[model samples]
Target: MNFFSASYNSNQDLLDHLKSRGFLESETVYQAMKLIPRGDFLPVELLDSAYQDSPLRCSRYGFNASAPHIYGKCLSELEIEQGNSVLDIGTGTGHFAALASYLCGSLGRVHGLDIKSEIVNFARSNTETFKSKSGLNINVEYFVRNCFLADPDDNVYDRIYVGAACPKDYVHQLLKALSPNGIMIVPAGEELLKYVKVDGKLKVQYLLGVRYSELELPHQHEIQISYIQHEREKSLKVLIPKNGIDQSFRLLINDQKFSDVQLYILGNKTPINVHSFIFYCRIPSFFKEFIEPQQINLSESPLVSILLPDFVTEKNLMMVLEYVYCAKLIDPTIFESNNSSPDQVNLELDNLHETLLYFKIDSLVEYFDNVSTILQNPQPFNLFQDCQSKHLQMLVQSFNKIPENIGTDYTFHFKGGDIDIISSETVPHLLEISDFYDDQFLKSHCESILAKSVEIDNVVCLYILSSRLNAKQLFRICKEFIIENYPKVSKTANFQDLDKELLCQLLQDSCSYFQLLFDRNDSKIKSVELNETHSQNL
Candidate 1:
């Protein structure tokens, strides 16, 4: 047999092996796996074991292509359809993309991104050969970019699958990229692997019991040397929040003379209500006392307390404490407590609000408001305020900034008192605030005014407002707007196609809309339709 056929047969044999090992579930996926030759994507030396169930190291670094079974499971989880668009993050060797292209058929598209340009180039050549040999035309695009950073454009994709484990903050970026009702599968957590989905709402399913490595930004040479120095010092225990873990660092000193010193902690740029510390400390022995036994309640601030030796100077202790607090404020972690109470949660929130105000994190105030809304009780708010929480003051200041011209078109109108009144520019500011806070009531009013205004440059704002509204409500509003003004807008606007799909997905209770769109008669909307056959496979 030729190398290609030999590789294909060996992969087919491996699929049978995995099935026997209970790694595979569906025959359709198994058949798809057998059709795509894995050897075409591997190096010559590794070609002998191309069909093996285990992962193979591909580069000088620890970069490795996923095992056949893992790739099969991911594809099976995706349950790709004939014409769906798929985005594969960290596309190693293009093996997964090859299978995805086959499953998606002639009408589908697949885009793969990898950081290494060399690997991407290699994948391109392999894909070209595979297409020629099989005579199966498939569309695949590869880009070299850091996956950790957010993409500038909002290309709402149908399916997004990440090969690397990402931090909690990166999850929001992935969710934003997904089309409403679209599914995303990611491996999350620092020490545990959890398969999370952002399908309409966030959901998680813990798949494997193994922990994957953290996805870190590329470090510079100078930063690497600095980190080496930092690591060499006696290690100091630093507690970091779930989101801040990657950015946090610990300081260690070798001086034994001033070991047991009292220190005060402070914060900056840190989230409000975090329990950080100001305290006296001794080296290794004192670290034990500062470490909390369990995760601090949402209400409690992180604190560090240390018992100092009698001989330690208060002046030196204060200097060390100030430095530690500065570091803590920059990267604070949630304190842990066994018996957290409602009062504690409020205190933490209050502290967090004050901290934000101190640092002037204007955008973070909105985050605080969202948190406050979730808590939803006067006592907690009051308790938080008692702790000198500045969040309420910030909220009040923010509320006062709401412009009077908000929700009004900038046009001259005749008043009943025989006076002509002109609208103001300040109105759009309210719409900005409404969007920030996700205020549905205010957004509807602002959208109505902006939709009618002749000077409004873009209709995107109105579309965003429509997105927040439910299908029936949004449709009612849109229908009313269209009937009263701009009746022919939808027919001429190509971008409205996405808006229509968004509305349909939001409004319809039954799957009839999808069913109709999938019908061959609907050519215009076919590209956006969800294939029922693919759903069945999932």
Candidate 2:
């Protein structure tokens, strides 16, 4: 509501100096800088370097009057126009406030805040003197506020300039303080961040970075809500700016020269050369028993060779390993299938399923669950035989087929990893030498030993399996079966072939069955003494 004008031609040299440095682009901003002489805002001793486009120390505690170009950039980003209301958050020495006041002209007003009372008073005094001496029609209100706070309902400022670095979450407060269509300029991390309020949400852009002090804000529980949102966005690479740095483990898996890996899978004569980095963590069950990732010294020792059993083929093993490393099935190249053939697709899917199941790798089974039903549907589409994993199906039906796996490849299921990752031929030798491979599954080559109709064969094999594989459920079931049916099973020919130790265990576990088998002969004889006599007879 006042009118006055004065000559600002005195700092035309400083104003031109700014323009020569490729700054002060907007005509209104350039005119605003020209009108507000820099000398009035700086200390008398610091006036010599005030025209330089760099931040100058305004306080003993490491605060600055932002450089001319930085202030110009903030002004340009603010999009200041006549009659626009502005809030300058850390108005040190009042230079930016004075420039903002000039741009807002006779119709606008500027309010400024600083945390320290001394700085706020100095800036207030400086702006008042500049207003009187220059005869400009501007009144900028300066106040000391330790924290950024404004009523959301009463927010009227069209533009806000933060004179400090703000945390990523402080955008919420900045948004709350701005009028509709307002812009806020603040420093976040190593970059200058600009946010514009639109549709009640703030959209952000990273502008150029500059050194600035941390902004002061009050504690409110709602701050976490904004911070969590910022963290979520930043994790998805939305808010953080990228510096070019790349890392990959492909060379460790594929390259031959590094040389810590030797995989001797069954059915393949050549050992697989792999880096420990590839499989050590991926196949934790196998690696926990065999590989040490950190203590690997490949050059000092002969190449570490591992042998897998006959049931696990090298082709199936390699495909699953590649999938673990790449997170997708490798392109179909293993079996030389026609690219368009439906049989080839089914074979690939079956191979994937069997490989995962054979290793008892339950974690990877979920990946094959969504495999296309066309490859799974055998009755209607396939002209040949069914292509599902028969090996996997056999294991699943093992409970129903009671002892039918004798002469079949019996996969020893070990938990917490007590078995060696080697061929069954090599493994039997390990068991003979030491207790290291204690978990063993042995099915005799004699088909009569595992015949389904023979209850004695099933009971003896199930007992042996339960003991060797540490299968508690099977052991309990076998105990109950032997207790109830031992009288009938005692006459089977397979009972004569059962190991002496199993015979003694059966004698020890069910004493009443012994009496029943003996037809009440010497019923009260000492059981331990009888066991010794029975062992000797066997």
Candidate 3:
């Protein structure tokens, strides 16, 4: 009795079957698959299932004539140009070799080798039955011997297929005989791997998971799937954290990092069913709602087939959803509290505000606006101007601006230290805040523009401000002002007064006195000056 046991219930024509299942990726491969009649390779007992792409027992211990899916993918990836030499190892049924012969045509040399004598003889008989009538004039040599020990008449092969599984480490030995630019397809342990020799080194790429065994043939698997589809394994973790409702919903929408299996829910709508995992983790406490995904919202747009609200379209939803995911990826400290910068916060709030208003998510507009004021009102970022309290207050009316895009990177040198500012990273770093409604996040992005204007007292704070908040553009100007006036400024009382000797500490205070004085004042300041006589009278 054969060691491997298989259950084949699928009813499909073998050529169409493997192609549909994705075992065959190209017209060349499908044509090659059609060249060999699978029925001729199998024993009489398996004729009923001959057209199917499942392994059949030829005789005894786990000797499987590889299904069309297995051989088809290998052949397609190899891309056998006419006249190329081909090798098949552990070729039990010669079905794989037969297909290879067809692709190589009249000028190609194809050889099938098996370690077992009976299987080699059987494969030879099988090849003989079809070779002549098949109308493909390709000579194939069959041998019963270990491929590792066999002497090759030729120095290298254009393409090689290994019918049995070997450890990934053994790939090097098989690769030795592969010509430069040749393709080798093999099962390394439980994984199917392809090796190509490029510029004199083997470059390996993982094809997919495979189960090749001497004791048992691999379970029949559907070879081809849609280009966008991904097969799901039952062990995938869907990231349904204990309080993970939002996470699962995002997974349902973006589905970028999840599995490719489709889940048919209510309303004829289908979404990617992520990798199968513990079902409990995939769905939230309210997961019963997904039983009917269309029931998610009453406003379903039939045109796009995506369930959404009035102002936001399917495209908008995807964009906003992506932004939400990006926000989550950010370090919480950037938007959380003291760890983050205000210009970053203000910049992020502005983006969120624009998106929210466009989507007419009126509810979030106020939240983002409030957060913006929080950043703009407080010292915002540690970046300070060398101006005093009065001058800084007057400048606040100028309104700090966040650029839609940053193009130039600048370098700044301060008595405190030197800093490099990146233009692109500034906004992404600020948008790290997860929630606009978070009060602390709102407070982090206030008016550093005003404070820095008041005094160059914390030049180090300005340096750190640009570094941490990625507010390089704003601080770059401030840093240049300091560098230009370095001689005069360094001699000032303020430069000598810094408690910390080094300009930049790992982390230091950024908010300056202007912000403190502004927040303390109940009324706006009007510029009033005292003459020497008036000062003496006071």
Candidate 4:
């Protein structure tokens, strides 16, 4: 066996030795090897031996970072060039992938595949760290995939390097993933081999004798578990507050620390200090009209002050500034006094909407339109009149800012917890308003709340309502609830309210559900019996 006769002190010394030994034949190979530090990819315990020519164990799955000589010879044999898209099969720790990325440069992309997510994640993290430090402008993507099962139709690369010993049967499968006239370097059995495709034929050449782990398929149960885990990860929902940058900007609204522009309202002597850039992006017309004409440098010039017209009240201007900073309308109740009447609140909101439209903040103008609807319909049947003002104000503030397609439930992320905004009795009225206003965002939220509120007392009526509204999700939930608690649901007063045709449909659906369950249980029994019989015979 050939090995390094002496230990090296650094990566450059190792590269110099490899070049002298004829392993590193090309300047691109030498530069790539020198640019990427091997110590960064090694485990903490093996960091001292990173410059050694011998392979080092990297994972419990029996993967190793190949010796420097082997990598150099492979890169030299592969003849990788700039702008060549490459794929690294069984890419562990991403050391070779990083070097390949540097070789490919800015115009090319590299892909790495490993079956273990842990290995893939480690490789991705190491590559990102290298990119950050070296400032490499290349796209190197890592994926957790079974190479044998990869779909060749998805993508083909100009260069493919297999880091594991591929079985003879899978060679043709991998060759299918190569572009016309593309080259592949792979280790098969005890000999490293190179294959170049030309005119739909593989021209093979033997490179060297090397021992490597042969690629193997994961177990059936492992594949199933991996798929289920992937699905669970894909569907994971996170609740993030809509108040990060907007909140930070809101705090500096009237603060003098970074203010470059000042506005003096008609009645208030205290100037409203503000950042000029906020207005520059959000309300460009206002910024150009008031702040731009001053033509003062933001950092070096004095704070320029402008007097507002009579219509821009101090109170309304403050609210406008809040909206300008937050990218959301302030709660109307924020400026309203405790003793303020509904009529007073309405008048103030009307003035605020006019101000928003005049400044061309169209989105916030649309938000106040919905707020007007919420105020008009305080509660379903006016049940909670005392808390209506405060609750509805919170609802309008939170709901208007929510994204249209926020996943699954409609819970507001408040503080660090979820706050449910919809009450059981209020769903129908809210649904009506959502439909009338052509607001699919609010309609989706109302349907989700209404579906959770289904019960024996109201399942029949809710079912009819869902049908009337053509709510497919709510209809399915109500139908399933009715089927599951049929005995109790049938005895309810509103059970007879279901018409004859709809009642027959529910009976048919229940029969289909029971029949499917029975068939699944029977199949399981037969499978067990066949297994037991085969075991007895053996």
Candidate 5:
């Protein structure tokens, strides 16, 4: 007798074996499994072993259904709640779909599809018992169509479970079908299983080591896969003061945008009114280490503040800030550092500089330049050679700016070189004159200063200048910088209504220029007029 024939004959014995292996955990799953009648789905030759815990060949060229244990684990991980509409891809025996239908109840629906017509027919036949027994009338639809290409009209699935091991690219279609809070459990990697689309994020939990047959899908497509090992990062909840003085303030580091850092408002007994912002670096860490003592005095007066205990490098801080600003979470290990003296700090900074380069953080190059100047040492050129060269070149190109020339004739009175420097302070009137002189000499000087403020580690200065700069220029700069250097920052930054108006103006201006450059032909204009008339009539 064939393997399937043998397995089908010992259905009770196979189920017992599966129980001993901890495959059949829930009573609902077990009952559904027992009632589904696997023998009906299997070919007559392999019907004997239909109920076995091992995988069985169902078609040519290595197409097979997963073992009972794997199927059970996948179902358990699904955490199915009642009233869920599940779409099962590569629904082999239709057994899993029947089980899902049972769990989802009367309100729930399970749609199973397969490339093979015979397999789909077999599944439909196998699940007939479930329809009669549940009386809850679980609806299970079987279709003989490809699962990879989605039907444009059907995008109403609550949960999607892919029955075969597919490449990560398949996630797009599954994601398109899944509802906002739906779960999609699929076997991802060659030897590893990853459960994704759970709670709007991807999570991987290790399962018993085993390899399974690859589920065939359509042509491969490009997909980004970011592999993060498990680790935790520090999180802080900060409150913004009610006063409007803090309005202009947005966080940044080394010119990189840090917009999705979590900003929460403190209320009575509990934190209320959470505002999520992302930035390229941790503000608290940068404030503690990089900014000068005089700058700290200015920062302390801000209506709002971010408090973080312990010191973190400017680079790590930026990474955390960028992750938060993008509203993307990172593993905690990315924030962990070996706390030593300046030597260890320098080493970690080197590692961080390399990481920034790898990830193509544009401002980090300037930051490294500033650090190099402070250290009076040059960095190794080949550190980031393996990273995408074009991305690095773009960063370099963005830094090319025409230096503004300012003419100045100023005098400073100093008491001493080192010892007596503490005894004397720069006269307030003289400082004011110097500020006025600088203001008078530069073109759009105030705007440049504000732009530079963000470039520095001065969050307060950046905010103040950002508020005072010409709305049109500031919006243009912010939009261009964000689009070029940090696309993720736009997700978190709360731009003023005026900023939107400025952007609209810029778009209108650009449209006018485009119209001048490409004047429409008389025939094309006539066609457009006719099309508009037809549209209006329709």
Candidate 6:
């Protein structure tokens, strides 16, 4: 990757330069960035510098449109897919919002928010003018509101981008609005960070360093009745309670009151009562089996009981139903936490992986299979020892198909091959050995496998490992997984042991990167006061 590049003359020139430097990786982002002229979003006086690969002052309120490269990096991190609902905080003149709209396409909706009414209006005017001239159907709306306050509902935006430096205190608040698996990128002090919301938590990754104005805070007195009324009006539009559908379906599992079918498992006397509607909705193929002529008895009550295969254990069955009912995965630890031993837990995991595959739940199947496979793989190599004969033998066996002669210097002969990682546990040792030998292929493969093998149980360990190895890609993935499963990952014992600096960074503290500037004897800057916006049913 070109870490440094020269400035360009025009918009197309800048796009080409950024693309060459590996900044504009996504074709969608490239096209959108190319089609939208940055000059249209800038003031007439500053229009001369619009095409420059540098930040330009777009608003009189001290808001600057980020450099084109910055936008490129942000877009690549967000990976805004089609039909996504995106929130652009600190929308400025709506340049990024326009690009995001184009990337998300016509089916997606983009909401741009800014505390300054003038800035909001400017963004609105710019976008309207662009739409008129370009004739591109960009669905985006701008609103005059506090940038820090996000919607309280959890299932709203698919992606969020904060243009200003976000203070740490507000990170959790903003996360409440992101949908599960959604991504948010924001600058915090000197570091640009990306956070992915997974399983109702955040995974944080540090992108780079930059200077950005702190997020504008609304005055305490600005919280007037009108704002509360507006918020209440917005909340009224959501008919279903937050997670209402999920909870309703989840509560139905094994509840005899509403169950229309009883599933009989081998060796278990009692059958598991379940709602037919749930199976019909979630697993249409399985539902077809239930409706077969031989399985159904209309003459009797609709409560039909069918014998399940021997492989369906009671423990595994409940876990499967948890996913079927609400698309939620029961924590794997709960399978044998109270009574089962380690061997039993491993066996249960294997059975669960098989069960998911048998049911054709592709996502869960892949997840459980990965977990099981990693757990059963060989232990990590011992870095302290010299190149042992067995280690060399294993390496040679891994690449036996290579045409080169099997010599003493196996590292030189084994250029690359279909080498399967024995275990994610071996990543740390392999990373060091590969780095020592300057094996880019092996090092990359180790990083890829370590990143892919990230599970809730070992994510914290992998994160700490990445930091020690200075594995940027692996660290990014681990950070993201941690964010998505924060509630669960935080409880892991390893979380409490994270380095203080890393923990601060993970929490999105704006000052984490700037601590080096703080004097040892002098007091540090005071934390930003949080004045949360409230709502009233007017």
The TM-score leader among the candidates is 6
Query: Candidate 4 on 1-538: residue-level lDDT in tens?
Result: 3555446999999999999989999998898889887888877878988999978887554588888888999988888888898999988979989888888887887999998898998889888887888886646899888876634235798899999898776687778778988999999888899999889888999999998877876543444444444443322222233444345456677878556678887778989888655565567666667777785444555577888766667778877887666544455656466677888777777777777766666655555678665466443221101111322222233234322323112222111113254456556755553443233445556677776677899999988887776655667778888988999999998997788888998999889867866765666677679889999999
Error of 3 at 241 (Å): 71
* CA deviation > 4 Å runs, candidate 2: 1-14, 60-62, 150-153, 199-201, 221-538
Per-residue accuracy of model 6 over 1-538 as CA lDDT, tens digit each? 3334345568898889889878889888999888897888888888777777777765575688888889998998899999999999999989899999998888998999888888898899999998999999977888876754434342378999989887776676667667889999988777899998777677899998888888876542332333443454443231322443345456668888655678888988888987554454456556666543433456746566778877789978988898776566545656666688888878777777777766666655545556555346424221111222333332233323322222223322232122443245555666654443344555556777776678888898888877776666677667767766789999988898889988877777324313422532122222122212222322
lDDT of 5 by residue, 154-184 (tens): 5567777777776666556666777766667
Instruction: Flag the better candidate by lDDT, 5 or 6.
Output: 6
lDDT for each residue of candidate 3 in 321-349, tens digit (9 for 90 to 100): 44332222112223456544788665554
Estimate candidate 2's alpha-carbon lDDT, on a 0 to 1 scale.
0.59
Task: Report the poorest 10 consecutive residues by lDDT, candidate 1.
Answer: 410-419
Candidate 1 per-residue lDDT over residues 481-535, each given as its tens digit: 4433433544545335546665454345225433543443454334335455567
Looking at candidate 3, the ten consecutive residues that score lowest on lDDT are 407-416
Clashing pairs in 6: 198-484, 201-483, 202-483, 203-483
RMSD of 1: 24.7
The whole-model lDDT of each prediction reads 0.49, 0.59, 0.52, 0.71, 0.48, 0.69
- Clashes in candidate 1: how many? 18
Candidate 2 lDDT tens digits, 1-538: 1101122234676557556655667788888787786778887767777666567786653478777778877898888988988889889888888888888877998888887888888888889888899998667888776434433224468888988888877666666677878888888766888888887777889878667877876654334334443443332221111211001222234345554557777766777676443343345454445555333545556356777665456667666655544343433333455564778667666766766765445545653464443235322211111122232222233223323232122222121122323343433222221121122231111111222222555676656655564444345456556666878667667666877887887778678545443542333345557778999999
For each candidate, C-alpha RMSD in Å? 24.7, 29.1, 29.5, 18.2, 22.0, 25.9
lDDT of 1 at 130: 84
lDDT of 2 at 291: 59
- Candidate closer to the true structure by lDDT (higher is better), 1 or 6: 6
Q: Which ranking of candidates, highest lDDT first?
A: 4, 6, 2, 3, 1, 5
Better of 2 and 3 by lDDT: 2
